[model samples]
Target: MNLKNLKGDVLELGTHKGGSTILFAKYLQNINDPRKIYAVDWFKGLPYSDEFGNTDEKKKAKGRLNDTSKEFVESKFKQFNVDDKIIVVDGLFEETLYEKLNDKVFSFVFIDCDLYKSAKFALEYIDNHLEKDGIVFLHDYSNFLNRPKYDWGIIKATDEYVREHKVQFTENPIAHFQKITSI
Candidate 1:
């Protein structure tokens, strides 16, 4: 997607170590737009990793991927000089999403968390806030070919959400869903 043309404020569900957050901010900067990108995440890691499977591989990943901090993430924003264009909302998706971002309208949303519950909640939470015809970018939606046996919760959740809401989407690797009507 062309980040240069993204309208309204941005919203991201998984900030992780601020990689994508930095990129998003840089894109906005390149366009010389002063839009804010609300990057939301716990800054810790996945609440659970059991969604992958009941095998040892999944168990080994429990509490894994938790190497980040608000201070560290903020540092990246500062380094990129996009700190002023980013708002950090720290907490689990369930606890912080609506509470912190309900007031804003978004033209683009990036859902990077790869879990069923997280994906579902993120989509629903952004429903009222995403502007008409705004697009939602979903990661892990087309990972089936590479990680077939791994947790497919994200794919499942996204499929269900789109099907239930009759949302249309186009997918290459990332699935982009454009909001057509109120869900």
Candidate 2:
């Protein structure tokens, strides 16, 4: 995956402090190519943590209302060294994604919405918005922990949908699902 010619739109379904977004954007910056990257989230906070686990509804609420400001998340990205190659789109997945971004075709999409409903929406949007042969990186493909996990909200929903749809899936140990499909 050289990604030198993968200069197309990118989407981030969830961006907590912009961790993985920085990874993608940092790579883009290193290559210095023209691409549009989007981070879709309210950025309030996560619904669950290592301490809270997935059972806590408050974690979900925090994820729903996580404190968000593009500048704030972007700043984090800058701290990680990828400022020039990222874009921030603040809003919910279903409500705002298609409204603002339906026209574009993405090359790579990362889904980390951390809620069942939102993750479903993110996967649906990526399925609709991505080009044929595009790649989708989904965080959390079915990791069982004795403690709660907030990210299951979207991942499990997406996992179920993907299985039902019979899309091809490849899992990475870092907890990402690589989906190769035509949208």
Candidate 3:
């Protein structure tokens, strides 16, 4: 994907440990694109539950994947030498997304929130802010790896969004949506 051709900035809805954020920063840096990558996350593990009644037993039983902090992610960015290319936004999607990004436009949105409600909110925000020809990369839209069983809300929410909005979608190993018009 040639991100240079895309317009506006980048928004990453989930930044666990900053792996994907670093990858985006490195790519933007290599292309000499000056657009900023906004990395949004709670830095805590998954929430207890969402509005759609989606829950993870592992999260309930063991508090899964909560070992990361915003400072830790920042350190990773600095270590990767792409600190200047990324901004870390700390908070839940419902609490901080609109407030922080209302004035910004995005040509690329990476959604890895992993829950129905989180993914739904992220997609709702993108519906208005994403620029024409923009791309939405949704993680866990398919059970490609046959990984441990988890909530399939991402799939349900995404499919519902696509059907309701009549948006253009590509059903690859990793499903994605291309915004062709502004709603």
Candidate 4:
């Protein structure tokens, strides 16, 4: 995604505790742009429960999101001094994205939702609202390969959609985007 200053909107899905959002806020502040930066998450913890392997870690993560995430995200946004410019949507993308992105186009979107459904939802939004030449950076592709069967499913889905739609992709897009734009 385009990591440069004060351009179009940027959204991050699955922000664990707003760290990456904070970084984006700072960059936008540096460039003096009033465009919105959004952080969307359910904040209800991971989708699966104890059935998956490594139950303890998932439980602990759920406890943090369930218990302390709101205060932590608010505090961090203040600390970063971009609180007003950041839009926090505290729900699943299925619940919030179309409303949030209504009539708006984005320059950058990061998808880190890990789960197949959320990832697919994020990709759908990117497909519809992302500006021409916009970039979508997806995290956890390695997990998709090495973790579970469904992990690979979203990868195939995204690849198929991109190919069928004829989307352009560049490696290291966050950096390369500054020097380029779409046809």
lDDT of each: 0.79, 0.66, 0.81, 0.64
Question: Lowest lDDT 10-mer window, candidate 1?
Answer: 143-152
Clashes of each: 0, 15, 0, 0
**What are the candidates' C-alpha RMSDs?**
2.8, 4.3, 2.7, 5.5
- Which residues of candidate 4, in runs, are more than 4 Å off? 1-7, 48-68, 142-154, 171-183
Candidate 1: C-alpha RMSD after superposition: 2.8
Error of 1 at 61 (Å): 4.2
lDDT (10s digit) by residue, model 4, range 1-183: 334532568888888788788887888788787778888887776553322223355323333445436567878899878798788888778888997666767787877665545566677777667766677776644344245423323454455555566566443312111213342
Model 1's alpha-carbon lDDT is 0.79
TM-score of 2: 0.75
Quote the lDDT for 103 in model 2: 87
Worst 10 residues of 4 by lDDT: 171-180
Model 2 misses residue 84 by how many Å?
2.3
> In model 1, where do residues sit more than 4 Å from their true spots?
1-7, 50-61, 143-151
Query: Which candidate achieves the best lDDT against the true structure?
Result: 3
Residue 131 in candidate 4, Cα distance off native in Å:
1.0
- By TM-score, highest first, what's the ranking? 3, 1, 2, 4
**Local accuracy of candidate 2 as per-residue lDDT tens digits, 1-183:** 434445458888888778778888877777765776788776666533322226665344554535666678877877876666777877656567889888878878887766666666677776677765566777766444543333455656765776876355665443444445555
Which residue pairs collide in model 4, if any? none
- Predicted structure with the largest TM-score when compared to the true one: 3
* Candidate 1 TM-score versus the reference: 0.86
- Tell me which of candidates 1 and 4 scores higher on lDDT: 1
